[model samples]
Target: MANYFVGDIQGCYDELMQLLSKVDFNPSRDQLWAVGDLVARGPGSLPTLKYFQQLDGAANVSLGNHDLHLMAVHAKVKRANPKDKLEALLDSSEINSLIGWLRHQPLHQELPEHKIIMSHAGVPPQWDLNTLRAESLRVTQALQSADYVENLLTKMYTSGSNQWHLEMGELEKRIYCINALTRMRFLHSDGRLDFECKVSPAECKDPDLTPWFALEGKVNQSHTLVFGHWAAVMGEVSSTRIKALDTGCCWGEYLTLWHLEKDEKITQNKLKKS
Candidate 1:
């Protein structure tokens, strides 16, 4: 059996299908690991969710910011952004099941045997694999709890609160963790999240801001980090330990899939323009 790690699909169902076909993926024999944002911005959000849902045990996902937004919108905690094209997904009769499945997905996934880790955004520089796993579990628990929509998802929308302090409450810490693992892209020199910067490192206006993966001696060097979520970077990072898979499929770019064992990359072009 082979393992394939795919980038943020972002509701590009046709591209996903074509990518699978290109790789000749076998659901029973090959495992699919998706770097989240499985829905949003493209034309087939509902179909994408349904297709992944039906994959059952063969597919594993790390939840992305867009995926969480869909959950919040479904729970009426947030309004659906029209640009996301998520209305069809929210209107689906199986919205509950879809959102439930999404909530159960963790913020990070580790393939110890392959020495690879996956997340929507790169893992925080301060967090090792063990800490990442533990913190991800905490977020998962909050998301899967009975009052998840009102208690956790609703409180997680506000940004610019990325710093973690020892005296913070459980809710505050959880929100911070959520933002760090899902929404983070750049970090200020003080290690605070730089949410305002979305351009490539060289193009960034703030010289003090650095990409999360570029923090010197920060990432766990033993394992390779595979992630999506900063489409503006266009799958470029200076570190050998970092692999960026988000080639912006929903924005009419290529959908990338990395084969773990073989270290091979297969891509499929977008079927429609954004």
Candidate 2:
């Protein structure tokens, strides 16, 4: 069976279907793995969630920052941003099941046989593969727990706490791990995750900031890192080991699909909102 890695769909269900059609994707045979942000900021959030929700064995995804925020909104921890066009999704009868399925998705997906790793954001330079698996699981288990909103997600909203400290309590620790997996973009010279800088490296004037993939002495080098997020990067990075999949479809650009076995990329431009 052929495996395809799609970029952040972000509720662009029409483009997703078109991309799948382009590949002649057979749900019974081929598999689609999304980098996440399966909902939000596009015209088709409800149907997009429903499509994957029912696609079952043919589809899988990692959880993105937006996806987590959706859960937070459902749990009354955060208000939904109207700009994201999630009204239909939030109002839908199936939102509970949809969010439940989304919460269960992992933050990172490992393709050990291919020596590749996929996450909403790339793996941190300081974390080895084993650490990625372990830390991600901790958050995953918390999300799956019944008390997640009250016990875990509510306390995770503190900002600017990117540095991982040995003395950190659960709140700080979970925030750090979540940021590394979801919001990370650049890093300070000291290798701390930088959540504020959203510009591409060329536009970034800060000399102290380095793209995470450009950092030296990173521990997880064995596996190629595939990630979506940091739409500003627009599928460009310093090395072959790093693949930036988000093509800014939500911002009037294109949706990208990475054909895994062939190492080929296919793209479909975002259609105008009806």
Candidate 3:
């Protein structure tokens, strides 16, 4: 009856297995929460996808940036760049079904009892649980629809404010995707989205652009935010209630798992890919 949340897997299937073995994870009784990026830049994307596909009922996964990139490529919304070595999955016969399943996953989830909130990338400082879930539902619904979601991904980057507006177009959607997945690291001095910096120490071109969790007057301080995406930050949430999970397992680092109820952590070292 314990729920464990894992950081970005990033296709490190072997290490994932080892971590699961260490925890003695029981699919029937215990549940697993994955913060997303189940594939990409690692050695075992195919197996990882297959294994998790089978664990459909036992686990909950939020889509990560890399996961969306895989989906975009699958849908022909985008091309596979040389850095993306996802050919195995793209060539698989079950590619459509697999991508469909991944796309259907929610962008955010809330566990009221534990006061736990989960998303691949951290939520904006302005959004509370209800606002986050509603906006996320809009994006998820659009992506799942047969409409040209390629347009959505195209506009998912964030060069302006972090706040969502009803007037935003496809470009904003793409910016939202980027902010939610890849381009998030620091907040601008004026509390806008900064798409450039990745290094920590929290200092940047403008020091006032604190990280999202550090923004002043955030409304959703009531719950604990558990997220991944920022490997450089390791597991820093900046704010007291927020927690990061991505330990950079795909980059020769450790895979991290945190127990929701006990606040215990388990780290598994990984073998680097050649």
lDDT of 1 by residue, 189-246 (tens): 8888878888777788888888888885344588889999998888878777888999
Cα-based TM-score, every candidate: 0.96, 0.96, 0.89
lDDT of 1: 0.86
TM-score preference between candidates 1 and 3, better one? 1
After superposition, the stretches of candidate 3 with alpha carbons farther than 4 Å from their true spots are 148-151, 157-178, 181-183, 202-205, 217-219, 272-274
User: In candidate 1, which residue ranges exceed 4 Å CA deviation?
Assistant: 217-219
lDDT of candidate 3 over 191-212, digit per residue (tens): 5666567766454556556777
**Best first by TM-score, ranked:** 2, 1, 3
Question: Number of clashes in every candidate structure?
Answer: 0, 0, 12
The model with the greater lDDT, 1 or 3, is 1
Instruction: List ranges where model 2 is wrong by over 4 Å.
Output: 217-220
Model 2's TM-score against the true structure: 0.96
Worst 10 residues of 2 by lDDT: 214-223
Question: CA shift at 72, candidate 3, in angstroms?
Answer: 1.2
TM-score of 3: 0.89
